[model samples]
Target: MLRSLSLLALIAASPVVAEGARELSAHEHGVGELNIAVAGSDLVIELHAPGADIVGFEHAAESDADKAAVEAALAVLGDLSSVIALPAAAECSVSAAEAELHIEGAHEDHDDHDEHEAHGHDDHHDDHKEHDDHKDHDDHAHEDHKDHDAHDHDEHDHAEEAGGHSEFEASYTLTCAAPDQIETLDFAYFGQFENARELHVQIASDAGAQAFDVERDAAALDVKGLF
Candidate 1:
């Protein structure tokens, strides 16, 4: 399967792909993406979106309700039997599943936080060196003015605490008995996630690769010969 970023780059070059990405990304709280790969008789689908689009809030879970919402969304995404409705002739069954939630309870949250902090520290160290060089050159005025942007430090901290526009990626792999019969995806995400009004879908298969734009009104995409 093509990597999601690579797929984005491949499809983004086209007018339709660019338009779809631009339109979907315009949503302050309404965009998401889906990557579908049909290899042999296996089907793999990945979905990603901003945390606010998934759980209704991008910040840390401060209440039981907040946590529950995130959990519920993840659960729905994990259930292959529900999030999609394949044609009866296809006979696709879930094989493996995984989801990444950078929110409070996720195991990856701690590691990601550590990496983020390290990156911030590296920037601070660089800034400190720059300030020292300026001091040696008698440029105290510039150094003093730099503090004006110091307020952004607080915002950055808040972002770290809230997971900053938190995003989730759910991956599902399925084994299909009748790959030839599979042509369309009845993605339930449109109905499932109201806040996520638009999606950009990319499909790669033996025939070739294509991109599709999904909106609230039209949640399904025609994928004839894609497999």
Candidate 2:
């Protein structure tokens, strides 16, 4: 009977040994979209913004256990705040969304490039014919070639500037996996003057499922009606 009791005690403690420290899911009010995901000791935060804005957040940890604690905390974040204090084992990824206007602009540019290339080929052929007709007038041919070179440089500059715009929409999706466990979280935030952003997060285990919502501040950043 003693041996049996000992075996039962060992079985009860097995789960605690298999599962490390519990961690919390938390949220804070802020000027932009903030998404987080954690698996075991790994945590990732994705920040979405327009025009390459800076992000900051203040994080506090009471103990090493807090490093692995699953408790959710909430606070308001500002431009200068440090978002979160992450453990050395944590990993993060950041990305910016392509602005719709910019994408349209790029497509228009590609079309313009096609048109320009066609026109350039035609002009090159015309220049060849004119060169043959005026073989003795090498100076005029040189001037025409210089003008064509300048036109090519102007087109290249316009293409480079259109590609360099920093304005963009931002969105993020994160995946976390543990032994026999996996979870995924996804969120997006668009910077509109008076719209609402929506966040949907989920966690799943063999035991059950959990869902949570990060509310949007209309006055902060809006992502509504942007299909």
Candidate 3:
């Protein structure tokens, strides 16, 4: 009976080892899909896992100077126990999409007062006479001022009632496949914004599970201000 129990324990342990091996292999190959975008000065990267846990990550900068900075940043990330270093030659491709910006404000029309002032000057008047004429012009200007003020107020109220606002939308797709799955999954990150200030992302499938991971990197890269 002791021998049989030992055999069962060994069988149970075999699967664990096999799973670890598979995970290691996956890590070595890295992710199947990668997407990147630039908003403002921030860089946003989204990696997808079709069925495997992301055990490692590697990034190469486009330039030598950027490479040094990227390497330094990776070093800081590697210090964390939760992260695993990826192979430099891992097979991964990144595609970036253009970012969208939207701004909204109340529109108004203003009369050309400068032109009116320029034409109203009289060459024959002395300084005192000009001052008196200006006072008289000011007195007449008040005649329709109340109606113009009310018109502006009404336009502002209409703008407020209409709830004028702007919205921006951006979409990026990543194709990643798992060893167990025969087909690749198209993971999408759709970002929406009411203004240029804040962003909301809607992820497809189980992508939300990895939101924290992406958010952490985004924050570190200062991508939050891109929206």
- Please report the candidate that would top lDDT against the real structure: 1
lDDT of each: 0.65, 0.34, 0.29
Go through the candidates in order and give the clash count of each: 1, 13, 0
**Which RMSD values do the candidates have, in order?**
15.2, 24.7, 26.9
lDDT of 3 at 198: 14
Error of 2 at 21 (Å): 45
State which candidate has the highest TM-score. Answer: 1
Worst 10 residues of 2 by lDDT: 70-79
Worst 10 residues of 3 by lDDT: 190-199
lDDT ranking of the models = 1, 2, 3
lDDT, candidate 3, 167-216, per-residue tens:
11122322222212212222212111111111122222322222222232
For model 1, residues 1-227, the per-residue Cα lDDT tens digits are 56998888777678865444221122246878788898899989887777777777877555889756866776677676555678879888888766645432222334434433333322433565666676543344344334423433443455565446567667789999998797787877767777878788888887788888888788787877777
Question: lDDT of candidate 2?
Answer: 0.34
| 1 versus 3: better lDDT goes to | 1
Backbone clashes counted, model 2: 13
